[model samples]
Target: MEKPPSYGDSNELEQPGDDRALPPATLYVAGRFVHSDDPQAPPLYELSHSVGFLSDNDRVVRLERLDYTVRQYQGTPQVSTRARHVYDLTHPTLATSPTFAYHAEATSRRSLCSFGMESFRARTLSSAKGYRVHRAARGPDHRLVGREELFTAVPARDEAVVFEWYDARGGLLARETDNGELLSLLVSAEMGPRERDALVAAWILRVWWEMARDKGLGRWDDGAECP
Candidate 1:
């Protein structure tokens, strides 16, 4: 398969820096982000227990077990045996630090993402952009795709641009904006299955992380961690 440069190799992306250097959390994108060939509307996917079209009542991918563990399913709304992830928490025997584990049958893939106390340093960035730091992977080897970053948020607005994800080359892979009701996702192109699934999983993590922060559920001396 054709490969993209990893985030480490990409020279264009700005490294995280002082919180003051970052833009305000309520910054907004001007217009629609969806492309001509996008899956649904201009803002492609709708946010819900299942990522699909709310307008048409279409259910594509179902996310099972939204608490600590998340399972991504493709077709019917059912449990997924392919991709399983443990986000922001771990089993009793595992480490306390927030991490991600992709489990498939007998084999184990390297974590698709991870979060730690240091991840919450940037107060302006969203949890997906700030806390979950890792790459999207494909296949049994879990080969990584360039870099992944989702940051910025538009706070306290009825309709606001939240965060966006980019490829290693600085191309927009996905952007999510939210209204009072639901989050609308916009994508640049027809992405691969793994890439699409990874984006959805990242969104779920973002939502949970914010819930933990808003409720003061899992907080540390420095910042918040999802419960």
Candidate 2:
């Protein structure tokens, strides 16, 4: 029931909220076989171009103390539903009412929203991944704050797209990936929430902070620390 202490040690944990400054969080997209809500189809796949939109597959539960449960989703196309939920191990009551709000869409080419993206922009920029940047879309009109950059990316094996947000430090501020594989493996054939397919993004600017604390070596644990 308890989350294994990250990777290395708990003492390395950064102060609350310190994660906001870290960059480039790595994302692993997989299906949601354990919680599929569909009556006939449960996610089941190992690798595929399956993912939900950023605005339709995500959820947020902000704690009263200013922390949060920021869960993003990732998956395969047929099972475009997955999630990443943040939890303050010390205080979990925060899951009740989230102060911040956002979502993503799974049916339409891995679309996304919030965390500084719009339905319009997300749809218009679905070709960011495998394709080279040809015609640049309109700039600086999204809802993101500070020196953040929105990137459209995709992994091999699927025809869908993924979204990522970055801060000035090149840290992966956030991400939204949906998986089609796990959706096929659901114990019960069922779909999740209405916005489930489209709402799977993550705010992880603090990924480094979490990793630093996790690996028990602040900053130094970064790849730069080795190479």
Candidate 3:
């Protein structure tokens, strides 16, 4: 089977300080990384980072080596996923700080995106960039009931992106955004399935305007984890 894109390598990405300056900060990605002496490479844990805000905001997230960035806009009617360019950073997780931040390229891929740090919100409102889940009815015969929703008021990180699930049985399937606006759910169906997690930000965000139209859902299986 083909591999899927992931944020496992991203959460640990942070800015690196000067070589002649102070020691870099330490980072922990639940399991993938631990503090180490080597500035070139930090310790790797399991390699799976749960997105808190990205899945909730549906924004674009980019991880460039030791640098990680998320993008969002203001006053724009169109709500979109921010984008990131893949670059080789001299400083690795072993040599970077946890609170450090760097540059981000939002419209590099397209022309409509505006770059900025993303903030996760707790509730979804009538604002310009808000997400909501609708549940009508399954009609004649639809299995599994309804879909789920991950709502956010601010749509950033550290906030509550209310994840609500609604199935036919009214089980209220659990859905939520992790640390970044990352979305996820345990969906079981015989039709097309979601291959990657919400950590697959760009692919899922870039083409969502047309509802994926002729374009595929966008996958990282094409090449190295650059995209």
Per-residue lDDT of 56 in model 3: 23
Candidate 3 Cα RMSD after full superposition onto the native fold (Å): 21.1
TM-score (all chains, Cα) for each model: 0.38, 0.22, 0.19
Residue 41's lDDT within candidate 2 is 38
Predicted candidate 2 versus true structure: per-residue lDDT over 1-227, tens digit per residue: 32222322234333443323322222232221122233343322111212221112123222111122435456433323333222211111225432222211111211222232212223344632221111112224422131233332222233342344333233432333334222111111122221122122222212211222235222211112100
Residues 96-142, model 3: lDDT tens digits: 33111211222122111221111233346633232332221222442
Give the TM-score (vs. native) of candidate 3. Answer: 0.19
Q: Looking at candidate 1, what is the lDDT of residue 111?
A: 21
Candidate 2 structure lDDT: 0.25
The lDDT for every candidate, in the order shown, is 0.33, 0.25, 0.25
Q: Which candidate's TM-score is highest?
A: 1
Q: Indicate whether candidate 1 or candidate 3 has the larger lDDT.
A: 1
Q: Per-residue CA lDDT of candidate 1, range 1-227, in tens? A: 74432332233332231112211111111121111232232322222322121111221223322212245578535442322332222111124221333211111122234321113333455433343334433434553232344322223222355666555455655566655333445654455433443444455445444543355232121121111
**Could you give me the TM-score of model 1 versus the true structure?**
0.38
